[model samples]
Target: MIALPPELLGQLGTGLWHVFAVFLRVSAVVTLLPAFGERSIPVRVKLAVAVAFTLIVLPAVPSPQSNPGLLPLARLVGTEVLIGMVLGIGLRLFVLALQTAGSIAAQSTSLSQLLGGAAADPAPALGMFLTLAGLALAVLMGLHIRVAEFLIHSYAMFPMGQTLSAPDLSQWGVRQIAHSFGLAFALATPFVIASLIYNLALGVINRAMPQLMVAFVGAPAITFAGLFLLFAGAPLILSIWADALFSFTLNPLDSGR
Candidate 1:
């Protein structure tokens, strides 16, 4: 059996503790991250991904307090977990924005009930499409690297083991949420406007041609227009969403974005 010296043992224990603390934070983030945290993914796979991320980030995190006792370490773990949750929730807003946009667009275009089973969550069909597209685009654009950098940058804004400021965090959370909703509306605006025009024109036609079955004629017309609008507008909508997500990833603290 190999025997370790006292000083080496202490150092090894501290190192392990630091890694474990980081693991807690990473694990919390992985539980709610966009692609990795999808409902379709197994919890075991998520745990492995979190551990892998912790290993990658462990070397970058600062060391733990000197000779910390059990209680302090436990509190530290709790703090790290909270921080991870906060950050994960903040980033999750991007996906929420996409979902919101999809729901709005789908409703506007009267496609809300079609393909409703496509999403992991119970959302409208357009929401599912936008979420899937946005997530796929993010992954294609190297979301994992950006997420790692976001985590590393978070340590600077919020050192581990420190109490997170409630007021500031709340304000930021609210602002981010409002911005997310704005993004959703912005993405879906084109569809909404098109819907308004179609409805207005249909109303005029129905008034002028009351003898004709306008409801039957307009339903197919609106549906066809919705499909065509989606075909033409999806790329642009996804591109705008991706830009906002990248901006948020690169600079979460920048409210100007």
Candidate 2:
């Protein structure tokens, strides 16, 4: 191979730092996305995914201004990391919608207490279902393509070295939290209605026969009915949820900075 000229070598060295910044930014987002972010995924797999994303994205990302000094390089890296984190966290909020729905469904069905133990994530049974559903839907929807598009658009909205404002972060967080609650309620509505009718009927039985152990009789019946309702309603709910998640993940203005 022919040797690169000294001037060309200098230019290459200067551009390398910019490439590193892009890699950091892209990797950060990949490391936080659902399937890749989960603790179940091996670190090696996550790293590989991140690396692949970085390579693909680097060409599209605008190069950072060349900074010869170490401090500027450090600052560039930090800015990229921050941008990545914000993007990741924003997308992660959609997952919370599922968790919230699951928790609501469990509580409404009176199955919350019966759940074996606290999940590592400290979610209720409904929340667990929601999480699994959302994750599965994300995987099925081809998350990698959506995420790449999101990242590309993000660069246009919140380019490198531009720190997100605190107020912007606060607003985004609050909006996401509210959306999570709303999505959960929407997902659990059918179950909630079924649960209400079941409980009201159980209450009537208790009043009619005070001597009978209504709680024992009602619990098993409700559990079986709830399972059936879940199976029947799950497909529609998951479909709606997948559509919502796709919209949220792809929304260019989601960052709202």
| Model 1 CA deviation exceeding 4 Å by range | none
Quick one: best lDDT, which candidate?
1
Clash pairs (backbone) in predicted model 2? 102-126, 102-127, 103-126, 103-127
Instruction: Give the TM-score comparing model 2 with the true structure, all chains together.
Output: 0.88
After superposing candidate 2, which stretches have Cα over 4 Å from the reference?
1-3, 113-126, 252-257
lDDT of 1 by residue, 132-193 (tens): 88899989999899889878877888788988889978888889999999999999998899
List model 2 lDDT by residue over 1-257, tens digit each. 99999999879976787678778888888877877787778899988888888777778887777764787767777887988987787677777777777777887777776563667756777677767876887788898888877777778888887878889777877877777677778888988898898889978998999899988888888788778878899888888877876786677355222
Q: After TM-score superposition, what is the CA distance of residue 147 in candidate 2 from its true location, in Å?
A: 0.6
Query: Among these predicted structures, which one has the highest TM-score?
Result: 1
lDDT of each: 0.86, 0.78
Instruction: Assess the local accuracy of residue 35 in candidate 1 as a C-alpha lDDT between 0 and 100.
Output: 94
